[model samples]
Target: MSVRMLSRFRAITHYMKLPDDYEDSQGLQFRKEDLNQREVNQIFGGAHLPAPMANKLLRILHGRRVAGTLNDPNLQVNTAQFSASDQRKALAYLRANIPVDEVINAGLRAEDELKLLEREEDGEQKPVETSPQDLPPDTATNEIPIPTGRLPRRRESDSPYGVSPLDRIRAHNIAKREAEEKRLEEERKKREEEEALGNIGTLQTQQEKPKKLSPMMQKMVERATSDLKEPPEMKAWERLLPQAIMTVLIFAGCAAYAIVYTPPKRSERLWPDIPPAAATCLALVGINLTVWVSWRLPPLWALLNRYFIVVAATPRPFQLIGAIFSHQNFSHAMLNMVGLWFFGTRLHDEIGRGNFLAIYFASGALGFMSSLARLVLTDGLIYTTLGASGAVYGVIAAFFWLHRYDEFKLLGYPPDPMSGPQGLAFIGLILGLHILPLFSKKAHNIDIPSHLGGILAGVVGADLVKKHMDERARVRAERLKTMGTLEGVVQVKEKGPEKAPQTAAGR
Candidate 1:
């Protein structure tokens, strides 16, 4: 027999020795000695057979031999009879001659040919298998079978892992490239949207515009377009009127106090000249009077100055509280009072009266310290800084930091165009007016440092408290998220009971 035939015979014998499930039992069963030449040809015939059947046939012919009597033409034979001893002899003959490598190569070749023929009969292209001959001379012979799914088969150049190492690296590079492209696309979209909103009427034609408005329409349009146009600032008198009336009433009350209970002066003042306790009592009295009469009076600038202003740098500590109620002018007093009214109302509502008062006084004390620090640092000599402006600026800062998202507009600026931060920025810009000594040349006359100090004190105080508020909000959000997840689980559990009735009815 040829080497190929001997290999085939050995493979069949080997396959038959596998577990029972892998064996085929069809056709003739033979013993070792009863088998003949006709049975051998029948087992190895050209008829197509499954792997199991072919293996069983080869096993039956394993060690059998051709009888000399069967070679004679006149001999009668029973086609089905084969002895176990004869089968063993044939198998032993084939195994003794066949090489193991030839057997493996032939089996693989046959499987490949069978697949190719099946595809061709079905009018499909046959896939080529990678072979030892196709590989480089130095390539290793031991290779694992590559996994293939619905995707097309790989070329010889492809790695056995289906994709080349370089291809995997290239794929990762492509993903990064795509992510960058998407980010740029989103940024471009945002810029386009902003540009479109900014040029609202650029695309509109002149004729498409509304005709000249009637008087009513003009007023409506004016109101609608007020945000687009800046308005004039309040005149000094208009701003100061509220403070001026309050001052007159305060002076009248002080004149009564002087007449009724002998007012003290530099020469006639009680011992310990401006006693600390007395000074504090007087300051509180003045503040109470200011608040009282200012409620009834139209403006209180003079009253504020009398109660709060202290000129000496080393003045009694009580003067700090006093200084917060003082004002330089009617405009100063009115502005401070206006700020207090606006911010105090909302803050008092949110934080409650007690906390509001605490914050207000704490803010005033901080502002006073800031002013004192500024004086100590900037000038060797102490100069008095006075004004409710510091305390009120603190209140405004607190409001802004606490309600940063709230929309606000300056008197001479657009409405809803500014948020709390923008409003604070506006205040800073106005304060800058006091610092422009080169341009305005009168910044030295104004206590710019005191104002800045008070603003900073207020910002710091408010920020400290606001942090606690923000943390509370964050904790609450997390709790709600966890609660929602638990609720979903409960709903799923409840659904089990609701489905049981339907399932039982169907059964």
Candidate 2:
């Protein structure tokens, strides 16, 4: 088998080995996770722990939970981000703050609980896991009966677990909340079903009392909703595939158009009757301008930003396309439009409108995809990027490639057109300005990846077009060579060999 086939086989096996969703002994479905930072962080934060403590704990958990080592009995989970002395100091602080008897009793209780767990895991008495503070003080003694199992969540309201008035009041509040949560879950399911059945509008029209949520309940709801979501990296992979598909689809579209469609003959046009190349440029500018104007409409701002901007945090693959013709402000929109009109028209006139658009859309999509890939690799997935600079760069690069030796004007010219070498130097200067800033330690909003990708696409696109054109020219020349002996036709002499003169060629 080939190396690619072997790699694919290995990937399939790896995915097959990944832990899947399964039901526990209680018939409750549990999704086994290799790692989910958001789920971990949410659960940790929901526990009312200090942010610093939760963060530190997470670092330690992550340090020990290496990807391939998961479920490996040999891999001990003892290492932490904190050094030995720091951990020692922390333990000492805890010891100083907590009572000695309480600590000793807690340790004893914890040890007994672990012993019970081991026995239960080995098919002996089922063990119960309990926090030391939650149990009675007598639980530390040998005479205290070992717990058989854990208390089930969604407990009975009337179950007696506390005695004091304050405790009773608290339990009552918790019971009320549990009931409310159950009701909300049912409502959510019903809403989902209604929406799926296309009856959501009717359902929404029905009068229903608004449910009031306490701050605690609101936090609970937020945590619950986000808890089951897959990891950002996983979702990122899902989004990446669509963007890749879109890029390839665009490329195919461009290729198909170039292969089949022929442009109409070029003709001079009067004012308002724009040339094909000019029309194409104007249409692109109009698209950018329309999106830019939408930025001003407050109602559509959220929708536009979400759909138009390429956000790393919540990436939408289609945004890569939307973002190409999207500009946030007037200055940015105008700058890109001017660049498009200047270089785009030149390239468009040289290439047909279809081929020009092929280069434009394909370059832009590929450019953003390249940038997103780099960002994901570096864990800078929270970033955002937008604009047509990448597509514009592509146009510039193609134009530069086509007109390499063409002399052009420059800033305050000394009555002489800039030489080919001068133009080359000027192009390098602009690219260098963008490239040099990336080396600095400071954070920059500039998108180096899109620019580089665009330039590359342009250069490659130009080379391919040149190659195709040359092939066609060669084929046509061959065809002309094969067409011989046409009456009243003059034959051009070959460069290499001289043919014998034909006296009666006109007959």
Candidate 3:
């Protein structure tokens, strides 16, 4: 496409989208519009109500406060004073009678009333003026009377300042009206803005100034904020069913396939024969590699990040499986794939491919489940886990468990085999490396707990595989023994206690 066409296409896309400020009242049924503590204070102070009505309302508020269904000790619910707790409760319960708009109007009245009272007070405080005509009859004795009382205020015309008192009062009234009009105009604008944006809370929020609260009141207010936090109503078990079901299928399918299907003798091929354990390992490595590579692409990273990592806080059970096959870093992927190739193929060759896959997938799934349990128990759901280290650990641990008795050479065939004790020491060293990092605060990124869970799963998988093999071996031996006895019995019957058959030459 040409640049102009592309730009036009972008504009169309932008216009097609709903604006960011658009909102719907879909949740209006569950939504609440409550008066905050400051709005409730206006009612208590009776700024807008008559003296009798304000007193009655206050008494009613106090009565309702003491009788509320939920009592918080921190709020001092029993106190006679209008405690902060009372204010909180009053705001919550009295929102019906004293809505936010009513409070705002009361504030509007308050400003005007206060301005008039201030003008009157200033008039009273001014020094009284004595007109020359009001002078007492010049004391018969020519001594001017020393004024003992306040004199009358100077008339507007007699005032030393050029401005008349009526003009000043007119200006003050005009200023007061202008301020009131400005307030009304601002509120009108806010209402219009709210209508355009579809936010009903805008008018109240802009009109009311949240009072600076004392520390105790601050704590009480914070405590009340829990009302905003939705309760934990999610059905986690439903979300987790996919992971549990898949893990079970892995183990069950392994058992069923290994026992029920029998490969014909000398039928082995690249097509028919079950691939070596390396096949499963390499397949898994490829999956992880594809995920890792995809993550590097700018267009796909967002998709990978959203779906691949199993975040404990989010209900994304399928991510439990995705996370096992995901790796974002090259070094992490290489190390895990290397470990799998080294140990997994050997383990697979001994155990059938079915059992090998069972160990790998089941271990990784259970490893994440184990980590999930830890996060929930310790309240650490904020952590997100993604990698194949857990599966790799399970493969390594299973290999070690099955070959516990065998001497192993780590470096070269010429090197001395690390016998039983030496092997145990090496395993211990590796385990310690995983376990030690957990105590340090800086090593939070390392998922040592998941590795430990995988190790446990590997040991269990190894034991089960061994028992299955032993049981299959016993059944085969019993069948062979029965066949041998039957063949002998058949030969005797064919002879019929005599020379039933002639020599081969006679025939």
How should the candidates be ordered by lDDT, best one leading? Answer: 2, 3, 1
Residue-wise C-alpha lDDT for candidate 2, range 291-352, written one tens digit per residue: 98887765566677667888766677678889998988788779889999998998998877
Clashes of each: 28, 0, 1
lDDT of 3 at 35: 37
| C-alpha RMSD in Å of predicted model 1 compared with the true structure | 37.0
Residues 340-419, candidate 1: write the lDDT tens digits: 76677766555433334444555565565555555555552336677666666666677676665555665745745443
Q: What is the lDDT of every predicted structure here?
A: 0.49, 0.61, 0.61
Q: lDDT of model 3 at residue 495?
A: 85
Please write out the lDDT profile of model 3 over residues 1-507, one tens digit for every residue: 655433221110111121222211110111122334455456455344344333333433433222221232422322334456545544554455432333333343345446546756887543244433347667678755432211233343555676565776675566556656878999888888777765566455553555677886676445533242432444556435665676666557656765665544446534345455655677788899999988775556545656688766553656667888898889999999999998888888898777777778767877887776676556665677888888888888888888766666655554554333444555576689888887777846777778887888888888888998999899999999999999999998978746644554467
TM-score of 2: 0.48
- Candidate 3 residue-wise lDDT at 74: 29
Q: What TM-score would every model get versus the actual structure?
A: 0.32, 0.48, 0.48
* Clash count (model 1, backbone only): 28
Clashing pairs in 3: 129-152
